[model samples]
Target: MNQKQLVSSALASVMALGLVSGAAAADDNKGKEKCYGIAKAGQNDCANLAGTHSCAGQSKADMDAGEWKYVAKGTCKQMGGLSLAEAKDKTAMMKK
Candidate 1:
């Protein structure tokens, strides 16, 4: 292949590799569930449904009952982790 064609082919291969790796990472969490009220401050996996923050590890409070992290399915409750609904209710109750 010509120089230009070789560069394009290499770039395409790199992009395909990135896509494949990302898909694999996502698949790794397929059977996981989001467990709330268990993440320590600045250690959350993502933003809360309550719109508290916009990124991971951005929680301002430890066990805020709003943030969540991915845990094995059916294990959240056993681990004393709350669901989104339960967390929200608990937060509401705490405010009163």
Candidate 2:
């Protein structure tokens, strides 16, 4: 190919790559489903990240009562478990 054509092709390839990479999904905050008159609920998947990461949102009652303090955050590949208390502790530390 001519010099100009080759350069244009390279530029197009780089732009395409950037678009693909940027399009990848990012970690999103979990969603809270309002727990009405019900007393208890089971584990619920909140968000799916990159076909690997999955999370479980804590109930509103637990958050308000501070009874079951915890949230699930991790990827399907490398998941690090965290309890509500532990998460609170971590957030406190981060604020410092």
Candidate 3:
């Protein structure tokens, strides 16, 4: 194939792969809930409620009451974690 066509094919392949992976991740979270105050240090799923960071695995402390991870729905409380509302309250209380 021509060089231009080859590059175009490669770029399309990469884009397709990204879309597929993103869809898979979304499906994987279908049955999960955001459970706060349960993630270990450096194990959070995404940004903390405090907005100190905006990526996964960026938590600086264990059970910060602001960091959260995906857990099976209905299991957060059983796991000693909090829902989003509860987590917000706990985080607010911690600032006092």
Candidate 4:
């Protein structure tokens, strides 16, 4: 095969693999829920409530109330975490 064709084929394969893995990850989260006040610094799953940043692994403190991570459904409370609303209130309180 030509060098151009080889590179194109490799890039296509990589893109396809990324799509498949992303879909698999979404499926894996079907049984999970967003559990706030549980993520440690640099361990959060996504954006925080305070809007300090917008990405995963950006938490600046442990259990910051605004930061969260995915945990098993119905297990956030057992893990000493709070719901979205409760977390929002706590975050607001922290700002006062």
Q: Look at candidate 3 and give me any clashing residue pairs.
A: none
Give per-model TM-scores.
Answer: 0.68, 0.28, 0.78, 0.74
lDDT tens digits, residue span 6-91, model 3: 99999999999999999999999999999999999999999999999999999999998999999998999999999899999998
- Which 10 consecutive residues of model 4 have the lowest summed lDDT? 87-96
The superposed Cα distance between candidate 3 and the true structure at residue 12, in angstroms, equals: 7.7
What local lDDT does model 3 show for residue 75?
A: 96
RMSD of 2: 13.0
Q: Rank the candidates by lDDT, best first.
A: 3, 4, 1, 2
Candidate 4 TM-score over all chains jointly: 0.74
RMSD values for the candidates in order, in angstroms, are 3.8, 13.0, 2.3, 2.9
Candidate 2 per-residue lDDT, tens place, 11-55, comes to 999999988766652223343222222222333343221223244
Q: CA lDDT of each candidate?
A: 0.90, 0.40, 0.95, 0.95
Clashes of each: 0, 3, 0, 0
Root mean square deviation (Cα) for candidate 3: 2.3
Instruction: State how far residue 16 of model 2 sits from its true place (Å).
Output: 0.3
* Candidate 1 segments whose C-alpha is farther than 4 A from its true place: 1-25
Model 2 residue 39 lDDT? 21
- Where in model 4 is the C-alpha error above 4 Å? 1-24
Clashes of 3: 0
Candidate 2 clashing pairs?
52-76, 69-84, 70-84
